[model samples]
Target chain A: MSRAYNFSAGPAALPESVLRQVQEEMLEWQGERASVMEVSHRGKAFVECAAAAERDLRELMAIPDDYHVLFLQGGATTLAALLPMNLAGADATADYVLTGHWGEKALDNARPLLRTNIAASGKAGGYVDIPPVGEWQLTPGAAFVHYTPNETIHGIEFRDIPDVGDVPLVADVSSNFMSAPIDVSRFGVLYGGAQKNLGPSGLAIAIVRKDLLGRHGRALPPIFELQNQAKNDSMFNTPPTFAWYVLGLVLKWAREQGGTAAIGERNRRKAELLYSAIDGSGGYYRNAVAPAARSWMNVPFFLPDAALDKPFLQEAEAAGLLGLKGHRAVGGMRASIYNAMPEAGVQALVDFMADFARRHG
Target chain B: MSRAYNFSAGPAALPESVLRQVQEEMLEWQGERASVMEVSHRGKAFVECAAAAERDLRELMAIPDDYHVLFLQGGATTLAALLPMNLAGADATADYVLTGHWGEKALDNARPLLRTNIAASGKAGGYVDIPPVGEWQLTPGAAFVHYTPNETIHGIEFRDIPDVGDVPLVADVSSNFMSAPIDVSRFGVLYGGAQKNLGPSGLAIAIVRKDLLGRHGRALPPIFELQNQAKNDSMFNTPPTFAWYVLGLVLKWAREQGGTAAIGERNRRKAELLYSAIDGSGGYYRNAVAPAARSWMNVPFFLPDAALDKPFLQEAEAAGLLGLKGHRAVGGMRASIYNAMPEAGVQALVDFMADFARRHG
Candidate 1:
């Protein structure tokens, strides 16, 4: 009956503090004349909110001036299709580094709009490890090289950015966006659906190297045309007002946590604590992803005795932890501990997971 | 400083009750222990919310069993492109009835996606009147006939539905939805961007006839694919949660107001009060739109002496009636009284405008 520590991958858990602030301001934001949702996008209140959010995002990522931070709709899945439309002109081919489900899905979403070349993949290794950047067959004249920095489903990640020579390196950074420090200058474009590490599902934050914008040309639909949206300050159409409002609160929360670097350190410790619990569970708790490539956000593991999986999930739900069920493709359990999941929540999950392993192993 | 009456066309005011309810449930809904925005779309809580919203909408609209209601984002403008893509196959053209800015924009948005045949138009009349339905040149084999029922900009409305027979007649009821009773059987499709009469901007509600469900055969992307969206219950991707949630509250409010009939009568009285004030101002105020075709949702009028426009607007703002400025294309004053506008607000605007006419004009 008490507050359940939500473990849903996305739309994921948010800071209760941020939610409380939003609750206080839902009807009238800072004594403004309307609900945050009712204000015009061109109106000063929303304009200021959007600017502050991007500024906080830049400070958190240590984003360079050359990058254009955009708030868009459609989840990473939609961004999957949009990446090619915005980056690859007509017949241009792009390189895709397929580390896991999200990377492959991104390529699938883009393939209809443009040609795609697979550079490297860890699927051959059963998604247990990230394919090394050295093994990727870098296409010399690719429009851009795309990869998912963190794979949500299989819980894989690339610790280092891919070096693609002069090729633009674009990443789907959904699961790990605010969890850690990232070099913004290294990417031509970095974007993701906000449901995971950002705010909510309706908003996507794209940090693009300013020069890549508008090169897609105005011929694209106004919504997908990054140049048009960027020029108009992303008010080309009516945006998801409340979602953007919540994002402002989240950004404020991030700043209070001393930006992404501090949060990243906390996130690192949380991941290590949970992984250690599974590793020491003596065949009872086994993770599919390799140690070096395992994601700090999503930790997917299987009970050695598969039959106990049903009871494990049932008891976890009854005990107040929810959404720990694994993706159908890789059946087991997935505990997603994003930026909002305090270290204590991870410790709680690790302790319960270990105790379950001891009794049922 | 009380909450002023906001009359912006879209991103307009919401039901005060709904805003209060959202404020009350900001951190918890039914003790779910998560902000509605943070709940996973796939979770039982949100999926139930989405379903209940659709069910409530069906009850409000009296939408039949055969029609599917889709809650997607990208607004009516996106639907301009999506309609043609989903309904118009290769070598097909769609018919459009252009009354004002909305219809013209829809035509422009659909240009790249599919060819358009303007079956009727009133653009020559400065968008103040509707072209008679009888004089229309119907495209013989057009995919569908598109039109805007209530022109938000020019303050026009199609008083009667044009009989399009089997060629699905689609209406963008963005500014007009729920203001009056509508016969759902009269059209094959009905869609509205939520900003106006619904909830917020990012969510677009489409009521598509069952037969037209999945005809978008050629590799349609996931977000806009009607059939795919329906099959996945609009969770093909995460939806705009806050917008969707607020819309449910609005729908609930509508039902409590005795459904569309009672709301329609109240809207009629509000529109009449404003127009009577405009007509009785001793030629000080002039409404350009024809009497028979004038819209109840948006009442746009001009001052007798254009020079006093600035003073009039200032005084109106001082009177706590905000968003009275007209669209840039038409520089005058427009008061949009949606379902949320209490009768007292309209009375207040009328009283303020009348007093201003006596002093300025």
Candidate 2:
């Protein structure tokens, strides 16, 4: 079992070259005579490394100058909690268009901080599709419109950004972050955990419009101040140095793969390959999500019988394909083909799925 | 400079053995055919690894069963902000004894959440020593009494825990966390970032008395609820898995080095070796901290003239004594000898200092 095709959703597959680089420099980084994890974040070496990472990220995403990129901790969930506190006034009502688990979670996390309105919800449809924007119950004077661009658990994605005029659009792009090129200026904030396409688990990236900050009308501890983090270059305190460094390596790798446009095309092909395999199974395999809402990052499908789920996972593992087990909420199988996951891995999975259907059907 | 003695205050030194092991396992971990960073935190292997780290820490510190240990993100600074939010009632006043920069920071972070009273502060004395406990202005019914056990920047440490009757004692042990064994039952909460003695940055450890949680009379997001994290085994969201794994490795290494009692003894010797060098420098080098309050983890010292600081740092770095430049707040030199910094490294720094003095005197 030497470097299997990992599809664990997050803490997902990373570029093998990046891992090799990390290993090669684990003992002594940049002739510093210590691992990157062992150095001071404020030191010239680590500070330069951190700056390079932010620069690469900004370049990779084509982020606007007005947007302050913050490398934070506690992942997207923490960012979800911090969103209302940072973006909205105390008396403001925030609109949420919940399409899946993560969007619903974003709403829940924000609810405690400010007035929240469920503009639209896909829960009634078992999260199989996004609720139509026309049916949304718009809230007047809403501070922001929140949604999950891609839901890891529900296997749903918004193909296009919703037009929420005059209000800031905040999206959790955790799963589909670097899978494609995004119009960074369209959203007030685009945040996600790095475990999926960026780097590792501990680090989170937030692309926040600078003007959207300092309007919460409440005293936040300096540590929780998004503006303060921006001012200090995300080093108001010691940052997750090693994770930041690895993320830099990942951004470099993403650039070498010809940036997001090329990566997005490959991702599209991977998704089509896996989705077609399931759709063509003819009562053998089924995916519940609407075709238009299918995620390019995570593809969740089920066999003809629930009894085959365990065997499907086992056989997949035996064939050196790992982390195919679905989220407990879904209870079937999920194959996550993130940016770092090669086309060959998806091809292998599709081949395995076909072979399994032929044997078990 | 193959590998030098890194005296960085934090993101500081790590055990060479642990770093080597991490490097060895970086490409494939536990036959998972994926780096630990590439696997799901919910996966069995990572869960067991995280649990093992907690077990080792509990064993090392003799943590009481009634306490819940959590591996969280955002470091000690975030934990400082969370303290009053989780531990105090809406109207409760928390007492803080400020020894140095970190203690003051903890108080600042807690102020926005609840009423805070500075029971005593050493700022008047330039944070060179802890204020006497008898001088503290303890509130009659304070929710908790907070203090920093060791300050990384100021290089001050509490020689002993203060006696605060009937009040829960919350200690931020970020700098001196495992440099010595402690009576865990004495404190209601002991929290710190895992960059110093533990393993790496990006992860934080909080050991809280079970009853202290859910007492904060406020609606907190589930992510902010320490109780919720405790209930979910710190997997309420994905914990920092790679940092947690490396922390586990460091804990195992600590045990092999005969646990905290042995480690503490060694740390004391390391501190003593460097302190004696400063003491014996004959006016050439000076450590400003009061002898009784000087840190066993970080030893900050200055030369007779400010002009010598640059040459001292340059010569030290050239001699493979890294991270010897002091914090900007106190411009001099600091030799942080955390548990991972071997006695030999301290010896090397002391030897270099004596030679520098002989040439420059």
Candidate 3:
């Protein structure tokens, strides 16, 4: 089969180019004696690889010198808890803003480690809009303020980074990491599993402020200790060497494609193309999220009649657009246009959507 | 580099045939519309993929029906903490039998969550021999007994699986898992990172007794909770999809190669051949581990003079026997003979050792 546009929320589509390179290098990587996966992370070859990947990421994100870029495992779900465990000490509380399902889940995940204060919540506000920064009544002694930049499930995104006002800010950028350039200095920590904009799942990249690590009063599980990981240069244990290797290759691919800036623009265009299709479909297609809070990564839309959703997705799949099924929470359709998704794929999706609306409306 | 033999411990070599199959399916797995990595673990496609892998593994090892096999992330290091979190909650002091580096590390990792009793330690025994089980000062009311079956660094291995008496026994089989047939019912939990014996790094597989799950008294990290993971069928969150997919492929390959019994016998022969070469070379080369305790996986040996180590490693690498350099803690040569190191590879290593000894003796 020819190339199909995969819009999986995560563990998602990578660049076909990356996959080809990986496939080619499956036996041997760039004259190396063994496949990159076969090498030790501590080996000189892998040391160079890990360092170069970090360098590329730093350059791509324009990460500040104070920030320590860590390649972690366990994905964002684990990070949801680890963030609190690392940043919030024993008996400490953190302020969390819930914009959608992701933020709520993050808070739920962190509940055991920290006394969490819901400083701002979108549930009461209909989960479509972000609470204004000036309106947040954050706890006076909050250890940090945590929020998700993009909610993949709810299709809500904060257009601007929230001003936490001296509070260390932590963002789970899983669904949208590296899609655009961001002011790294604004946050204490930003981490994302690589499946979406980076490489594959299993490799979680954490850009943490060096000083913010190791502050948790209680002992952390070795893998949860950011300081330990940083001190060992992310080799505290046998790391997922092969995943990191693929991520390094993805970093190289990202660099070759003019980095995150260009990729971000392309991603924005893809989302815009798809969103426009929904808007222009004459009430046939509907988006639940407010326009200002709509995500550029995952665009979840609904058809006027729910019965047509499956057929729409099936037909879209036939036309080379896959994973357009919406999350179970909001069962309609979601077109997650991550970094690897080409603008042409979005155009195809849009064209298919319009034809479907005409056929079913 | 004519299919060089790699001996790097953990993240070691995989079968050339398996690698080729992986290469063939890297872009498109089986007849699935997308690569295995792109398919959701929750989907029927991956459900079958994971099931088949488990089935193959069980068949190969003669695993009993009472065990629940879980594919997890974060490697064995994650299990170092999680084992206690999952098992030591209801019971207090857990007994750990430390054989070498990994055993010590695993026990140290488990220390924070529970009271770890060093029931038997080989550290005082020079880390060359497994301590006699009769000498272990068993802790009364001990939750469970944990040990590393094969110590990768010190090249020490348990000659027999420790009979923990009535207490449950768990083994971190990272380096030796799936290389041989195992009595699944003999242990409470058998877990390991897949890099050593299966596919690539990032994914870990555990064969846990169905009864030993969800015993955590305090709320633990969801990812660390085996029950939560098992409940979700190891897909509670997006797993390391690519790693898990590759692991499935490796397990399939393992089954195809006449299963683990055959692989284990081959491994035994390989280990015997290499060890005999070192033993036969008289004082030219020597393995530090006692004869009975030498690992079938990692075999660490010393040159007659320490000064020749560098030249030895360099020449060996040049000769296409890569990663023979010993770990830093033990400065010498280490030949890790995992499942992937074919009989031919071991023979090659044996030939090289004998030839080198004759030239330098």
Candidate 4:
């Protein structure tokens, strides 16, 4: 059966190969009598799979040896609180550079838990561009500087990591993870929800510097303790084994597709092709994000006439391109071409976009 | 593929039909071109699935209309902290009846967060029996009385709920959820990890009375706030979509098998058959749990000598009765017969037990 080009921002598209593999392994995993979800987390098969997932993720990202890669639950939104809980002292200030909705949300969440300073904010500019790094008013003795590299809601992405001198950097890469290669050493901690560019929802991955652990200012739940989770290899509790297994399969597929570097190039091309379609639509289609800040993973665009938005989405769905509607906050259309979206899927979306523009423009 | 009779304590066996259905739907769910995992949580399909899962579960358990069903992450372990975070007021006392490892662990996690009183402890009896209700020393002004209905590690279960007047009753029913009929009205909150009788690990369900929402005394992460979760139908953040889908399928299957009442009867028979085999083994097999308190879900037992443990496990594995080895805390053997285990699987275990006894008795 043919599959639709699913463009969901998260709980998004996954590699067809990974889904097929999971289907085959549903009843029996490597001759084991149960599916990976049915097996024990401490069992050899799942343990090996979990290890390999972390190993491959490290290899792909070139994570340093001093970093602990933890497969956790609660997603990146949960990580907003956990990052401060695990990294910053109760009395210390944590600087937040708010690029879009997520960073602002993170700052709001961390406010009651710790002292926070808005290093910079792009909200005044309508979340259309990143605040210039040089203008950021960072706290001199801040615990860490947190940022969101990409905002899924408005399709804002930072092209480069901001230089924070000796201060540690933390990022929420939920929308752009594995879409490109990243410098793991530049950040003290990097985490993302495993829905885009990874596998499913509910599971999250946190890559933290080893020394940054065990320093939380207060007693936290064991699940929120990074050191405890890292020491136990993210099995501090029974993890989302199925999501973790699916992530391993996606990682395997990512490696086979020539790792992050190759995928990054493909993602760039997909973004360029779709953005070109939007730019050439002669005001028929418009994207609010600045040209330099356009996210390669999530492309949010608007139609000149809001009345036609419904038809565009209806026609797109009829043509087998799905989930192109923008987030409610953005209120337009978005095409999230994650790693799992082949160039053909982007081509399908672009083809539908052009056809819609011609019909409605 | 042939399946084994898996007896794992958690992340346990699911109905074979559910697994097969998941395999069939792995590539495409219904007419949607993506697997359920690949869809947006806010999408109609997933929203419907989540609603139906809660409905079926409510019907199976006879949940009252006033209770809100929340699909969450972090498992029961996370619930330990969340229970107090959401339920107990600042400085309010909460009583715990320590029947096994989990209850003690919960108390330990809650101690710094709130005032906790241990109403009773079964540790004095080696976790072999439940403390009598008359012996409980509950605090008069306690916000809640928490208990674990079944101790997975030691195969101990309370045959009846302890009467805690005025105070809310919370239970961690991870090991025995959906295995039998339960009076939903009797509980203030009933939470369980969805690995044993529900679906996979990582996802948890909490059925809380609606009035309990927004009573949290302390600031909490949005994800940890049950009121926020219930208000948003547990989509406060991206949930474990695949686990949630699989749980829907499991719930559907459970309904087809005559709901919880019939399943409970079947579970009882399976436990009876397995326990009888151990009891009639001519002093060769022994179970530490009191006969009245023995869990129909988890049956932990020992052999005549410790030396036979390895051989017994090896033989059981060879005979396709996998994961029969007991928890590390209670070293011997255990056969967890959740609702998913068919009568044939239990009969196979019973037949194997008799044959082994004949040869080694």
Candidate 5:
């Protein structure tokens, strides 16, 4: 089968051009007479390659100089565990605003190390909407405020950065990183796994405010210290070199696609196309997320009946659409259209959704 | 230039055949119409692929059924920290036998989390040889005995597994894993970064004796628990899919190359060929490690003078030999001949060495 529209939540679709370049360079990268994976991370070529990627990402995101961009392993979950360990004191309380599944996980991961306050929660509403900021019961003099900007599982997102009032805002941006322009200065830490909108699995990116590091006053294994990673340029140990290189290629591809502003517009258009289909489907299809809180990356929708999901997926795959199955936690159909997911792929999904509804309804 | 023999210590050379297979499958893997990296880890195809890799690895290493083989993120360094956190009680002391750079690093990583006792150390000898096991100060009730089977930077290797009575032996086999056959039952844990003798960076393999897990009364972030990883099949969060797949390909390639026994014999032969070249150089070339402790995987040899080092590396690259530059900690040259490095490449390096020595001498 030819390459289809892959909508996998993560370990998701990558741009075709990047894959081609990776294939072309698989045998010998940059005249080194070895594949990029086969080369040493500390070697001159790879160091420059890695540096260029950071530079490109900084330019693309307009990252502030005060922020340190780290390319790390262990995915965002590891960072979730590391965040409180790295950022807060042992007895400090941290505020959490839970809008969806990922937000709940962030709180769970942090609970072992610190006192956690539920600043706001949408779980009682089936995670269909973000809780109003005015209603949040934030802790005074808290260590930091943490939230998930885009929840991959429940398809809820916070469209604006919440005001935490002098507390650093930490975000798990795994599913929606680089999907739109984000203000780097607004958060103390913005971290995510690279598998979603950036590149592939195995690599995670963390953009941290420099001043926040080394303030935990807690003893940590050097490997788990975000400040140590920052100091070493994330090469305190052997980094995921192949993943880093591929991420570099993806960053270059993103720049070629006219940076984040242009890509953001394109993503907005894709999200609107699919969401409009769900909204216009009348009784045949329905998305549960509130209109304002719906994620532009992951849009979970349900068919009129549970019995139709299997056939709907089968027919969609037959039509060259793939990975539309929703997360098991929420048993319904989900179409994850990230930055790498072209507008045409979303269009094809919308078209399939309309066609399936007409026949099944 | 065509693919040269890459002698990088880690993030090192991969099997060309495996690289070819990865390249071929980059666009559409196993009829999924998506790169293997783009597929969901929970999906049937990828789950099966990940499981097959584990099966092949178990078969290749003859891992005991009582052990759990986990494919994890965060390099060996992360495992070094987690080792004590997961395996030892908070108050229990763990014994460490340090042979070289990596062993010291492992101890450093574990120090913050545990009571560490240096049972033996070769560092005083400038890491030129592994200390005699008979001389080791055994800890009567130590939680575990840890050692680096092969020290990559110093080119030192333990020729035999140390005899430590009932205490489980934990070995960081990062640089020499799968280079030869060994008894898996003898180990409590054998963990390594995948880049050297396995597949690529971004993935680490841990073969842990099942009983060793959950012994620690330490409260850990669930993500840091090896037991949790075992229960989840290393998918407590997303695993590094592409690295896992490529590792599977490498394992299959290893099997096709007549399994570990044959590969071990071939590795021995490769080691002999390069060591003989350096030994026969008649004072022009010198390897500092004792013959018994000299690594079969990494043969680090020095020129008679430091001045010749630059020209030697330049000429080696011109002659299509790459990554021969020795670690900065030990200046000179290193030729890392892992399982993927063909004996023919070693022969080419030997030939290059002879010609270069004859001219330079």
Candidate 6:
């Protein structure tokens, strides 16, 4: 069967080449004794696989020599809890910039564990814009300044990394990871769930500055301890071996496609194509997000008539454009064009949208 | 190349059929629009897949209507931390039965969260025996009694489920789940990491009694909350959807293989064959654990001359008997024959062991 254009926000589309390669190696990885999933994490083959993945990712992001890349489980939500435990030194306030749902949710997760203060909030405008860095109220001597660079649900993204003024800046880049080049040295940490731009679900990646670790010692759960994970090579416990391996494959694929810079251009083009389609609809369709803050990864838009939503979705699905239904938090439609979504897919989507708008306008 | 006999504890072997099925459907699931990994967890397809997995697990284990099955992430280690926060009522002392490394590690995790007491210990015997249940020191009004039914590293397994006498009993069945038929009503909670005896890594399943939930209020992280997970259908956050789907496939395979009882019987036979080979080695090879406490899933044995361990492992790998090298904690040889390991694989390992013993004796 021909593959459909998958535009789901996350656990989203992987490159077709990677999927085929994974399928080929599903039963036996690299002509090894067993599948990558079947092998031990401590085994030579998997350890090498994991190391290669980290190395490729580091090279892709141009991560500084002092950063530690960790393959973790439980996704980004669990990472939110771990962030405070590992980085938010006891009694230090954790400053969060709430741009959208994920930032708000992350703040909620961190609240119980740390004394937290919102440095900035874009919620007043229903998360359609990012408050400029100049306006953010930075906390004095905060353990870390946290923000979501790309909020998947609200389709908001930061145009540039926030300046936290000597405080460690951490970003939840789950939505926009690998879609563009990131200045790894500017931030103390950046983490994301692997399902979106990386590979599959069940694994998370944390590129954290080395010095920020081991501060809390062994008081936290060993798996939640970034220092311990980095020290033990992310095998403190059994990692999601299969997912990690897939992430490696995806990273390798991305590197072959000329790394994040080239992919970023393609992502920008895809986002522009879809956004142009929405804007060109002559008030028939709309994206509530501000142009400056619009995400290159997730494009959320709505039809003029609410009653047409059902038929639009049904027709979209029938046309082989899948997972276009928007997040329930902001109802309408979302076309998530991550690194794997080619310009052709966006063209296909734009073509469909134009045809649909012509008939339904 | 033909598949080797994978003896790794976990990220262990899955049924070849399941692997093939997964490979075939990696790009598109059930003729659906996206790979199960790409699809949203809240989508109709995944919800059905999760429900089917739960239903199959319930049927296989004979889980009562009062139980809520949860497919969680972050393995057993995370669950250990979740237990105290979820189960232990305010200021209640949680009871732990220390059998091996995992039990001790779990206790360590719980200590920071709650007042915990070692209800029993196998440490005195170097983790080679289960201190009989009758001898356990039950804490008065203990919130819950937690134990490892099988310590994968120590190669010790309980012959029968322990009775905690009206207190909630939680078992970490990571190494032996689905390898045997479990009476779900015998405990308040039965959870296991899926890498062993179930499916791939990254997913853990929890079978918890309904009445034992919702004790803790809004204090805990929502992802760790069992009631919330159940209510949201384990979509509390983006789950390890691919892992969860693979788990469903594994459960379906187990059911097709005539449910847990049939699989358990086969596991018993595999254990007996491997153990008989070890016992028949006439002191040339030895297993330290008490015979009555031997695990049906993990069979660890040591050669009389530990010097030959390296060559034995190398030769075993060359012979397509993979991961025969025992865990570093207990160095020698371990053949973990979970539900996925065919009887032929165990036979091959036994044959290899006999040959090795004869040559090196």
Superposed Cα deviation of residue B136, candidate 3 (Å)? 0.7
Query: For candidate 4, lDDT tens digit of each residue in A1-361?
Result: 6799999999999999999999988899988878888899999998999999999999998999999999997799888888898896789899999988898888877987899899898888899998889999999978999999999998999889889988889999998997898898999999989999898998999999998888876887675678889889999888999899999999999999999999999999999999999998888889988899999989999998889989988999999999988899889999999999999999988888888778777
Ranking of candidates on DockQ, top first: 2, 5, 4, 6, 3, 1
Give a tens-digit lDDT track for model 3, residues B1-361: 4568999987889878777877888777666556666656666777887778778877887888888888888888888887888885734889989888888888778888888888988887679888888999898768889889888899887767777787888899999898787787899999989988887888888889988877668787566678988888788888888777777778777777788888888988988898888888877888888899889999999998989998888888888999998888888989999987888888888888888887777
Tens digits of per-residue lDDT, candidate 2, B1-361, equal: 4998889888988988998899999999998899999999999999999999999999999999999999999799999998789998668999999888889889888888889999998888899988889889999889999999999999999878888998999999999998898998899999999998898999999999999999788898888989889899999998899999999999999999999999999999999888899998887889999999999998899998889999998998899888888888888988889999888899899899999899999
Regions of candidate 3 where Cα sits further than 4 Å from its true position: none
User: Which of the two candidates, 1 or 4, achieves a greater lDDT against the reference?
Assistant: 4
> Could you give me the TM-score of model 6 versus the true structure?
0.97
Q: How do these models rank on lDDT, best leading?
A: 5, 2, 4, 6, 3, 1
Q: Pick by DockQ: which candidate is best?
A: 2
Q: What is the TM-score of each candidate against the true structure?
A: 0.96, 0.99, 0.98, 0.99, 0.99, 0.97
TM-score of chain A of 1: 0.97
lDDT of 6: 0.87
User: What is candidate 1's CA lDDT for residue A351?
Assistant: 79
RMSD to native, candidate 4:
1.1
Question: Cα miss at A41, model 6 (Å)?
Answer: 0.5
DockQ of each: 0.60, 0.87, 0.67, 0.77, 0.86, 0.70
lDDT of each: 0.84, 0.91, 0.84, 0.89, 0.92, 0.87
Clashing residue pairs found in predicted model 5: none
Tens digit of per-residue lDDT, candidate 1, span A1-361: 4567778888889998988888877677765677777766777777888888878888878899888888876677777887788886768889998888888888877777777899998888888897777788987899999999999989998888878999999999999987888888899988888888778777887888988866754355555677767887677777766677778888889989988889999999999998999898876789978789989999899988779889998888777787898888898899999999988888788878877877776
Best by lDDT: 5
For candidate 1, write residues B47-116 as lDDT tens digits.
8888889999998888999888988866887777677778756477888899999898888877767667
Candidate 2 per-residue lDDT over residues A1-361, each given as its tens digit? 5789998999899999999999999999999999999998988899999999888888888998999999998799999999889997668999999988898888888988999999999998899998887788888779999999999999999899898887999999999987888899999999999999999999999999999999888889889888889999999988999899999999999989999899999999999999999998886889999999999998999888899999999999999999999999998999999999999999999999999988987
True-structure lDDT of candidate 3: 0.84
Residue B82, model 4: lDDT of 82
Error of 3 at A292 (Å): 0.4
Q: Compare candidates 3 and 6 on DockQ and give the better one.
A: 6
